[model samples]
Target: MLRLSKKTDYALMAMKHLALHGDRGASSAREIAEQYDIPAELMAKVLQRLVRRGLLLSHQGTRGGYQLARPATLMSVADVIQAVDGPLTVTACSTDDHACDQYTKCSVRDPLWRIKDRILTALAACTLAEIVDDTSVPTIPVTLSRRTPAPVTER
Candidate 1:
């Protein structure tokens, strides 16, 4: 049942968009929203969260829009998710000091927290640069044949 919030999803999408089209300068939330058919209001809010987190920089002008605060390679998915959503957790006790009544007796709590930490680390390893690079290796890449070239192609 673990899943990312809608706002986090939007934030990641916005970051990727900015990284890809950053050469064109900033991109208004409205433009990105329209491109992806996301609600303009929601997109604006998600982008604002990123700006507040210092993952993005907002501009104010006739052509005002948003841009990445740093290179995409420097921005981690975990950072963007944490900005939109407080933090990633697999259980209620992952971040809360006060746990459920069973907290003390729960045998699985510790293991679950470990899982959450690993997940977080994995997310941090992925950067906006990787997401926007659509040229990633194909799902099924062509491989070299093992057969020799027919005994040096005798005439």
Candidate 2:
């Protein structure tokens, strides 16, 4: 199953909190972590990673903390995730890297690559603003809907 690491999850939560309360000035990592019941040390590490990645700006002072380096609308979710977890990869051997032992006979490799690209595209298209905003963000076309289809009728 596809999943985001715990650190990545913390980074996203911190970002949303920062976006929501950014206007109030920089927020200390402890403050944000406490709001969500996360470990302060771990959240601080995540924020530091974001800071190093240029996704967040760190302020050094008595009242200083961390804040978004740019507008939330301009930063994609992919940026945040990548900063926290490096690159996103769903398969063992992506098209660019066929280092897997089964690369030669892997029939599903190419198709999985396409699916990986789609996932990356979707992540890159979604902005951090959408996470904290109540308004709708544009929806992506989905091949599968979780809901069951109604019975077919005779035309």
Candidate 3:
């Protein structure tokens, strides 16, 4: 199943937290971790990775903490995910590694690659600002309007 790693999830949470408090100055990793009930050590690692990726700025000292390197609107979900988990791949064949033994006869590889592209595009379209601003809504609307069939008459 396609799923985001836990580190990516934590990174998104931390980014959203910072975005929400962008005007409040930098926030310590501990603060963000405590706010979301995540492990402080893990959050620190995630935040450090973000910093290395240039997505976040880290400060040092008594009041040191972390903040977004750029506006949340300019940072896409894909950015955070990629920073912590690398590229998004729905199938083994979708990646350049291509270690699958069936590479020579993989019939679904092309379709899977297309699907992976679509997923990545969708993630890219979603910015951290949308999440932090509570504006993240599905592009496609879903309706549950199926009618219930009447009970069959007894014979």
* Model 3 CA lDDT for position 74: 95
- The model with the greater lDDT, 1 or 2, is 2
> How high is each candidate's TM-score?
0.84, 0.87, 0.86
Candidate 1's C-alpha runs over 4 A off are: 134-155
Ranked by TM-score, top first:
2, 3, 1
Alpha-carbon RMSD of each model: 11.1, 5.3, 5.1
Lowest-sum lDDT 10-residue window in model 2: 133-142
Residue lDDT tens for model 1, 1-155: 88999888888888989998999999999999999999999999999888999999999998889999999989888899899888787887754575588877889988898988988987888778988985751243459899757666567
- Better model by lDDT, 1 or 3? 3
lDDT of 3 at 2: 91
Off by over 4 Å in 3: 141-155
The models' CA-based lDDT, in order, is 0.87, 0.91, 0.90
By lDDT rank, best first, the candidates go: 2, 3, 1
lDDT of 3 by residue, 1-155 (tens): 99899999999999989998979899999999999999999999999999999999999998789999999889999999999999788776655666889988888888998988988998899899888877564575557668977889999
